[model samples]
Target: MAESAIEVLGVVRPVAQVRHMECGVVLRASDAVALTRAIGADELLLRVVQRVYLLEQRCATLSAALDALGASLRQPRAQAGAPNAAPLEPADASGVASEADAPQRAQQVVRCAAFPRTLEKRATDTLHERGFLVRPSNYDALACLVYMHGFYCVGVATKEDFGGALWEKPRTASDRAEGPSEQKRARAVHGSQQLSEDGGGAAVEAAAHNDSAATRMRQTSAPVCRAYYKLKELGSRELVAFSDCSVAIDVGASPGGWTSYLAERGCSKIIAIDPAELRQTEPPPPCVEHLRQKLQDALPGLLQRKGLAADLYCCDMNAAPSLVVELFTQAVPLLKPGAQVVLTFKNVYPKKRVWEAERDAQLDRLRSVADDVHLVQLFANTPRECTVLCRAKQSTEQ
Candidate 1:
């Protein structure tokens, strides 16, 4: 039977050689003339097989690079006393050990790798064969360098990576025995090809790197709830009057997170207002009263009816600061003699300025409306935003 024409089209190289099923080189074909001339069907097939093997080898190398890069970025820094290091237990019930006996945590490892293109299943298989474990994990790009080579070289030191920790979970018995089904394998290969066609492997690697870096940042930073606790602590000492028997108004209060914090701090009552509905998994604190209306519209009427005012008005509405300032000014008259306001101003304007200048300008504007204004920029554990704590002056004549 005549051999089928195996088109060696679009591959990196045009010249191809064939190897038999038993690994013997049967023939070499550089072009059409060489392919057709004197080759029997079996020999021609062998030549195609050799070319495929070479191509697969090249692909395997590329895949290894990709995996290494990913591992480096995802791997966490090693600490000296971490589980992987020398084990030592505390002698006391408090879980505190004598300074002399404590083992220092190891420093984090840094390693990196790069791939020319997205890898297919075959590439992953090759990596496994080459002694690289399939780490079912993800990582950021910058950290990639540290993970691949760090631990192996440093032998474990004590320092946490700011990015995040790496978790290595061993595969289950079932997972080790099972391979992806044909359909899934095909889909993965197709996906890799698509990624390569659309933006190439480098772009995909870059995105994965960025995502991992961002994840690390989030993990290391304090949560919003924690930030509130920290703020309460700060206010208790530096500005004790700010929280003393205070009546507060929380704008855009949904989920009542901030409102709950204020309530816990012994605020007299909090008029929680938001256009959106509050979704509370548990009953709200007794001090909070939910009001369903926009702050700009509802605050004026609510203030007029009360005749007296809130001690602290906290605006966290996801709206423009200028508009928020206007609404706050309108509601200012309703505040008690020495009320204070805490608001967050998101920089939604087209132009950007230095952080100090922007904060100062906002404080200056507030001073114009109130008898006394004090502004403190609270560096909350959030990115791209800060808290502005303002105090209203008390009239001395009254």
Candidate 2:
């Protein structure tokens, strides 16, 4: 594909060559701080900008890179105020940088999440040699030198630059999981702020820095299953408000990955319907009721329970499309209008156009009974897999 840049930024960007879009990080060429502010304003571009680092230099050695970085901020500004009034060396950044004001904003610890573990040690050593004391925790790092691949990305960032940041991959500090795709953009964002459902400039900016959302499905603790990350992102994105949700229904909930997430999100009651066993069954959560039967068999008894109307329904079944459609149609009456629905289209497996056709049929079936049917590719999902999201439109009483 041709090297390109979006119309708004006016800067040509290089898209990373990665298998999945979620893992592919795009590096943008920027000239001014205003360019970064522009990216924060664009929602579509925000997804690609998981992290933002002002690239001071990409030197052959870590020491050389730090020397170059110090030189840039050293520029004598007659005004004696912000460091960025004069254009900083635009390395390979395409996204946001914290606005310049206080001088201490530049204090950053040195770090890297790229491959070749040696690079991380080398960068830290070089920073230490240069008098940058190692912080006890990544969160305590006000800002830091971040290395990716062989590129030396160092610069000044905000105080919370490293605080509560998902700088390292889960269970390890290595970036091997991200591979070379981690080197996509020039500007880097620290651990991104918590996700916000309320969309606007702030949310876009916050999300731009948080790679966790872009990476999707990161659990702070051990997960029941990989599916935990999907629902985690859902709550992070505000697609499903788990905090307000009281009752949730999990269809085909074997091994209870989705059900486990529902309970973690604070759902007061989760009815997991599956023929097999859930991993959560060892002790079984008090909040969960396991109905070990098919959706069709368990649904009738499930509905008769007093004062029960589920506010959320999640269906992740690996069965025939028509059968799923049949079961969902039957269960649609159990929801009140405005209830949220999430389903995984396992049929998206690559076989040919046949799978595509199957996915399309399911889309049509969902749209007939639900409002705002949105097809989304969650970060936790494989390239061939996707998820269907919608809200119930009609009530059973009607």
Candidate 3:
């Protein structure tokens, strides 16, 4: 089989946007091929697809689906658990899956709907019944997504094959220049297919990525204010360990949403910079020092302090992207080498393409002072807003 062997099974609708957003297309052959062609071709789809599935069988009922699934699995799988597809033309030594593609476990996508809600138990049972090992894994999963009407689609791929799988999870220095994964390029090449301007077919044709975070965000509650939940969601991945930072600066920390998060992380010295009263300070956060002034004025006072260095600087200031970046840039000089920064670019404008284009331009400015800048549209964020993560330049790892 070639590396770029599998086709998209169908539109994988995330449950949250099934009714509200433009999605919920049932996967069909024509749509899958059209979507497959667009995978690397379309600027959007390249970031959207997490995994490619070779549709083996689809059944209406959960039991019948697994029964058919068992039969498909019984067939000799591609050598070393490669999916039932041809490889993209081999590129180099780095292009191979090697042992990374080995059959691990049958995992399920966290976003899509599951019928009978007993999907996990039943899947475990079927794998056991078929005489297969069932060691579950989130890193490299042979995933299944159950759509509306008990529709089921099972596919095989590895963490590398779906190289974009972790793209949204975290940011790293190497990822800045790493265009696409070598394994991804080796297995899947761009097909020059474009979705028609009339988005009727695309509603269900090209579904979005899995792991919808918006649903999780709505379910979350915070003591200070809802803004606290943003950092809670941001740090939940453990990619940027907030606990490692002893000192932090929460810009625009009024209602104290983000300030509360730093306290929870056990950050020793926190400067809450804002003019408005901090509602969370009524109780007076033990680790926080409230700077009751604008950031520019607060900077002079903060510099006078004998030992002033920040390990983390976080801002979710409700302002234009340009103003936000400008304010964030001013604080870069006060940070310890390699201090991490987090900012949320609010969706003040209506269009994604326009804001995103402007967003990247602002991010490039950070290049002078920071490296490994990442712009991600998080599930926890509002529809158009995005999260930016970067490390201060000229910093050594602590």
Off by over 4 Å in 3: 1-221, 395-398
Q: Which TM-score value belongs to model 3?
A: 0.47
Q: What are the per-residue Cα lDDT tens digits for candidate 1 across 183-262?
A: 43344323242232112222222233324443454344222232343245446446535546468888777645567667
Candidate 2 stretches with Cα past 4 Å from truth are 1-16, 21-54, 58-164, 169-226, 232-245, 254-257, 264-266, 276-283, 296-309, 318-323, 333-339, 351-356, 376-383, 391-398
lDDT of 2 at 285: 81
The full ranking of all candidates by TM-score, starting with the best, is: 2, 3, 1
Q: Deviation in angstroms for 395 in model 2? A: 6.1
Residue-level lDDT of model 3, residues 221-290, one tens digit each, is: 4245545656766676665789788999999888787887788789998988999877663567689899
lDDT values, one for every candidate? 0.43, 0.55, 0.55
lDDT of 2 by residue, 270-328 (tens): 98899897876457789999888998888778678787788998887877666666777
Model 3, residue 328: distance off in Å is 2.0
- Candidate 1 Cα lDDT to native: 0.43
Candidate 3 local accuracy as lDDT? 0.55
